[model samples]
Target: MQTGEHPQLQQQLMVQNSSGSLSFNSNLSKEDEEMSRSALSNFRAKEEEIERKKMEVREKVQAQLGRVEEETKRLATIREELEGLADPMRKEVALVRKKIDAVNKELKPLGHTCQKKEKEYKDALEAFNDKNKEKVQLITKLMELVSESERLRLKKLEELSKNIDSLQ
Candidate 1:
């Protein structure tokens, strides 16, 4: 065989040459031809069976592939639907977060105002307590002055009565 000759062509050529030689030499009988024909028929039947089985398997594979594609499309649609539903919720969440931030910003000043008011209230309470202490001291001084005046008036009255008796 030449280097470039295909292996399959070489095998066909060899088979043809051998069969020609056998027929020319009368060594291949009619019974041998019949047996070869039967074997070829059997081989053809087997090849047809294999082809049928291959076709059935191919069809089954195609059906399964179609089902898989449908399933994939269904799942994709479901994912899209879920995402669509979530869009509003996602926006609502963002809005709620913004509102919370706004409320927090407003509360900061209120907290400071509360602290200032608490301080003012404490200062006022301290002033009131100091004034109450001063009032208690003034009331004590007033009671002492009243007692001294009463004692002076009684002594004056006794001196006047003795003078009247001497005159009589």
Candidate 2:
């Protein structure tokens, strides 16, 4: 055998005549050929079974992924519905708060005006009471002056009458 030459598998063929020589035949024995074929057939069957099982597993995984996708979509829809349900109340609360702010804005100026008008009414009432008191004082003074004038006139009339009787 050479250093780089690989050994070959063969059967020796025996010749009956022709100097009874032996020659290497390239084909294997019948029993060895049958065994090799049976082993190759078994390997092919196992490969086919593995491939079928792989396909089944792949299909199952794809189905599970599809179901997960659908569930995720449903969860998203539910979240949207929940947000929708809460939005109206938020809007209503915001509107009510705005109305309250507007009312407070109106009330501030009105309250100031009411206070101003109340002070004016109080000043007017005080002035009216002062004028009434002044009127009462003036009436008392007039009554005193009338009484003095009447007494002086009656004394003059009696003096004049005595003078006229003496002359006659």
Candidate 2, residues 61-80: lDDT per residue as tens digits? 99999999999999999999
lDDT of 1 by residue, 41-90 (tens): 66568879999999999999999999999999999999999999999899
lDDT of 2 at 104: 99
Off by over 4 Å in 1: 1-85, 161-167
Off by over 4 Å in 2: 1-93, 158-168
State every prediction's TM-score relative to the real structure.
0.44, 0.39
What is the lDDT of every predicted structure here?
0.76, 0.72
lDDT over C-alpha atoms for residue 143 of model 1: 83
Backbone clashes for every candidate come to 0, 0
